[model samples]
Target: MDDERLRPTQLPLNDLATAYVQAGQTLFLAILDDIAARVRLAHPEAAYLEIGIDADGDVELHGIWSAQESAIGTCRLLYDPHDDPEQEWRDGPLDLDELVDDLGRVLTGSFLHHWGVVEPHPVYEHRDRRWLVLPPADRAATVAAIVRGHVPDAESLICRFAERGERIAVGFEQVTLSGGGTISVPCPLCSPETEDGPWPRDVSHELARILGQLYALPHLRGRHLTPCVDITAEHEGQLWQLVFPYRDHKKGAESS
Candidate 1:
């Protein structure tokens, strides 16, 4: 077999295809901005909002109230399609005012639960309106909350790492709207084998997968540029630390 023939082919995009992709990206950003604006209007006291969009277009919104350090109100919007076949295949009419009102109610309930006025429900249960009241001083619980707030199936991911006798701690060192920033993941098992060794393939792969989900986050997609994450992992009982920089390849040029 010829050497060139064995290699994979790269397909070139025409002008129309390029335009189509650009249009889709622009519309996606617009929708995210609209949702964010609504959330802000509803909960002016929210310190920061974390939004997660799934493959099915369902949206998960979490508003973290800074005043109540341990309070988080969660709301999920299921993608409802128009029932009429003759109509264009699109989402049904969504009442923004009603949605915000419901979110307010959930936040109120969360506050009541925090103050011991209402009984708290199980954290693992799935509900349309849920409140997570975390312990302010617990680092591991806070890490788990951050992971669960953004990633789908976060519990499973955490359990998987635990099963391997590894604990993962993620910190956002710096994040910008231009998709440029650093995420620090400190874990002994994810560290490189040697000082001058190459980046750990397993760790990089897992981080890349998680970043793909995070890329859809409204706060990070400002310039549509691929973001880079700097991971620093230290081995257990070791004094030295290794820094591995991983670039997300979802879009834009790779960073060195």
Candidate 2:
């Protein structure tokens, strides 16, 4: 298609984008409400879901997964009408109806996973892959099992832990670096108070030990997956880097 044809001509399409995002957000909030009810029954002070929309029209879905706020996750979705695919009229001049359908599909597929309402999407190898849109209420064995279908040869799983409703954040980069690639994981919880603020040494060691054990399982095993961990923590006006060599489950485990 020509450049002109690639551009969406109607402003109404922008409204359509807004509608899709709104509908998705509504559905997402309802699901979270149910979660809060169940969680509060046992822990009346349970953490609740919250939504944030930036000026650029990007939607951020984030919240704590427990009363103690042990697990924290966020998923960002793009909904700018002027952006590509939204602007680039595909096949023909953009059809508002079709655009709305596309927007709905993308939103529905992703908004739930962050809330733990559904399993994390299956695709993980690629850093930028749009996962298949799954139907609502589809449960799974474990969050890890969601991607068990795809066993990647080499993977860098960025896991974050937060407590006390995001006031405190701890992140771990569990890497099985392959093909001589290097990675540096930045702390997501970056604030003046948190910056240069050191997390205790014991907490770092404990997190590393737990992650090492988790990924060492048979289901998570990969041929190219090596056992090496580089942990980063920011505190006291400095960034701390810790290297934990993977120990093999049997003899020579750490050297593996």
Candidate 3:
């Protein structure tokens, strides 16, 4: 019955809402910028990319595409990380190649899985339909190349391998670096019989070059988390394994 009782209280709800919206916008923009930078680096010709998060926490992309010199391009993309056969394509079409560069590699997947905060139990193997295995020594060098952004000794050799459509093979030798450290490099021609043998000087150098490209990616380079991987590679129907920085990296981060 009283006039004061009938009126609404003047709470600062509008200010509170504004603050939350601004904070959310900042976070969304940061994530988009990160993803976009990585995409552009991988596809230098990428154009008009737009990534954003909606109010409901849905991440989205727009105006992105890739060009192929001799191949027809797809107009749309399927953004599902798990590669679900039943998943529908995203409303927006991005360059599939660029998107894969940003999210498909093991190092990039690990980065997004750990930092994107979008899912529990991130699925890295979804992209691992094919991978390589290398000895621990090669893994350690590859990891170093990733962080350093250049293959130590095989720059020319990697280019040669690239020109010839050859790739480094991974091996399964049971070796571990002191402190669990590992490295990576691009690879040379692979041999199933010699999977466990040490890489030739040329092969090691080329592998380093391949890893150098991965390390140079903005998402992987700028991330605060140190990545350690079990390296695997795919090349011309050959399957091999390599090493990455996992246990040793975490231990170092924790100790630091």
Candidate 4:
């Protein structure tokens, strides 16, 4: 082998690795910015964050949605479409509160979100554990509101029973939009940027999936493929500004 031909290929770790990470971050945010343009237009001060790929090739994404909020929140809405549990409830009242608790646990277990490149099969229920039926339609909004009030604000993730649909999808949802559809407000698949990917587009992929779940809830159906995006920004100490663009936000790139 020629003397130069045998030179070792550099690995990502220190400076180069950090630089690679920064570059990846830049790429991911650019894609999200392009995607976000479909949502709220643009902000000169805002930038969506991109947590770069992990050493394991795993990627987590985060995005900031508004000028006031620096964090992009991810929310999921869940409702058992199968009325089995509800039907059982029709028989009589049985530990419904306990059932809600159990159901919450079941949904949290769905937290793994994305398994990446592999088949997206999230374990919905564990041994002896299944979803608990929600209260009657009249009380669902109340329950959802209470749940939201109790959850940590930093999570930017909300789960509620607002829609009349049978799909549980996670999305980079807009808090402001009144109507729906490709032309009205840009959703994940609705955007032109939607395409095949292993690129930072993976971030977009994950974000859209989660947003889909949040948008369609209360009447959640039987099937789901969890989509997650991870993005983190390190500050002083181990603290970091994290955004899960799964809300479909791109905090604008840091201006040079």
Candidate 5:
């Protein structure tokens, strides 16, 4: 069978990310875009071009050819038992858990890529192999799990300290999850004074972007998976707003 026949059509990363945001499961937009970029770097051998739209919604990366095509004839993707298979997330209906799992694999795969490089290949010499340490797929999953906390039976988790400052603040209100798991995370950057609502984009970590995508997943509606680092700065005022996804506290809702 011709591989092309079975070859799945790759969706443009920006388009895919937009689709995810529209769907509501994209937890982190910047992070997801970075992941897409990593994918482009990995499969440099494939002679496919990509187009990315800018913030003004203008096309940014159109008609761009990969840099690894020439060396791909001799280059090979390193595989490891410890490495998670990133091929599974090509089309992606990726959820929080799935994203975390895949990110972990991608991190491990970087070693595989390095070890396989016996004769130096110039095609991908300048390629971004950030995900070589962790495939784009696994990097997302791991980060999602960290920021989004977890639920083990009755106990739940939330982030109390984060290295974040300016983003989007969707109003200060505790929200509830679909499963009665409530959490109160502060969207400090959501406020008009703080952020421009639709925060500008940046090239964040590939795995971090995967978590961001999980955060945006439609299935994660009102689900505070990513934990926010509580801004307890004396000048900033005490942001005692970390809630677990359990029946105990409500998200954004002040803990009683």
Candidate 6:
């Protein structure tokens, strides 16, 4: 058989990608529903929940309940993707019993009252899916860490742009596995004050490239699979709002 003839066509590849994405999305949503049910049962007043994974692969679940006073409690869980080959793309464990117990203990303990008022992050609806946006401070910190770690030169260029009163914004408007992703960066030179100086298109492009890679970072992707609905950053007047392509096991798993 000819090697070229044996190769899969683009349509088949695309179909495979779509199927993989749907599978991951379905499993993720099911897990979210389970978590919500478990948490609500323990704390009937629980109105909001946020799950986050840190660089060390530790999973933290935070639940908030409102009565005359608002209270927040956090519980940590271990998540090792290597433990389950069948569900490697998932961010947390398939089991929720341990997680629920942990949250229950914390919410009932004295620690719950110490934490100040807890505010829920804004939620955005897209089709049948709803995702929470990270707080601006957290989002900015994460973006800065990613850019500095991946694209070192971006930090300095951003600083220079800030000094000159020019802002550089790098973000993704959309990304798809089949390819034609859109990266959004407002033109710094277009600003009246920046017209007198040169714009560093190279740095902007590099920043955009690095931002696109976020979809593949396992630690960043929470239990929801999609990290957040939007990631925005601001440094000395420079602001960025990034929305990367959804990554499924088809590409994300291979990269990981």
Per-residue C-alpha lDDT of model 1 across residues 1-256, encoded as one tens digit per residue: 8866633423334545655544443344334345435444544433333333345544444333333334574433222224466653322343544554443443432222322212232343533434332222322343333443443223212111111111122222222212333233333354434332122445434443233222333343332223333222322221211121222345435442
Full ranking by TM-score? 6, 1, 5, 2, 3, 4
lDDT of each: 0.34, 0.36, 0.36, 0.29, 0.34, 0.36
Stretches > 4 Å off in candidate 1: 1-23, 47-68, 71-122, 127-256
- Provide the lowest-lDDT 10-residue window in model 3: 156-165
lDDT tens readout by residue for model 6, 204-236:
454443332222223433421332333334323
Candidate 3 accuracy as TM-score: 0.22
Best by TM-score, which number?
Answer: 6
Off by over 4 Å in 3: 1-10, 48-64, 67-256
Using Cα atoms with residue i matched to residue i, what is each candidate's TM-score against the true structure? 0.25, 0.22, 0.22, 0.19, 0.23, 0.27
Q: For candidate 5, what is the lDDT?
A: 0.34
Comparing 2 and 5 on lDDT, the stronger one: 2
Per-residue CA lDDT of candidate 3, range 82-132, in tens? 356454344234455555444333223232322222232112643322211
Score candidate 5 by TM-score against the native.
0.23
Candidate 3 overall lDDT versus native = 0.36
Worst 10 residues of 2 by lDDT: 134-143
Candidate 4 lDDT for residue 40: 27
Stretches of candidate 2 off by over 4 Å are: 1-9, 42-108, 114-256
